[model samples]
Target: MPDAYFLPDYRTIRYCLMKHILHGFTLIEMAVVLVILAFLLGSLLMPMSEQMKQQKIRNTQQRLAELKETLIGFAIDKGRLPCPASTTNGLETAGCGDNTEGYFPWRTLSLNIRQDAWGHPF
Candidate 1:
């Protein structure tokens, strides 16, 4: 009797088991938290996306204006508009001022932006 181990009684063991089993949040609570996090992230990100779109629009507009000024400068110097580049490639596909009508001579004028932000030729 002096060497016997002191085991916990059944009532205490049951109480400990129940406490461990009920310790954490339920599955529904976790789901609700995840839903709330998703809503917060979505709301935070939406305005940023719109601002990015607006910035792109502003950039395209600036590029277009610069392109106009460059063309005017070229006309003043050369006495005629530069030839249109090929639609397929960005650079001037033919000789300069050969058929300078349809497209902007971006390559001939040393301009880098061959197309607008929307991927259409300037």
Candidate 2:
């Protein structure tokens, strides 16, 4: 070699390093990333639907509590409790049990609880 120092400059070294590091992702790498994202997202969202169902159950219980309060208020206002309304037509046709335990009368109460969570009738 000629009498000369051959040290690489900082910019040359950086460019060479970046040439190796800044390449596009390979097909396998892309697929792996997609799979990892899907797994993470699925893991996050899997319990969300179950949580939503639990929220619905909580809401139904709240509605039931409100209905109870309304019924008690009505009983307090009137001398006797109102009869249970028909599930189909909402007409006051069903009588309460001997102790006044029965289905909630939606129509008589003028409440909007035709169906509970999971599409079941109240």
Q: Top lDDT: which candidate number?
A: 1
Q: How far is candidate 2 from the true structure (C-alpha RMSD, Å)?
A: 6.6
Model 2, global lDDT: 0.74
Candidate 1: tens digits of C-alpha lDDT, residues 1-122: 54455655788889988777766546658888999999999999999999988998998999999988998998899997667766635455556555355666677898887777778877
Which ranges of candidate 1 are over 4 A from the true structure? 1-25, 88-103, 118-120
lDDT of 2 by residue, 8-74 (tens): 5789889887777656446558888999999999998989988998999898898788878888888
- Please give the distance, in angstroms, between residue 82's alpha carbon in candidate 1 and its true position after superposition: 2.1
User: Backbone collision count in every prediction?
Assistant: 1, 0
- For residue 33, give model 1's deviation from the true position in Å: 0.8
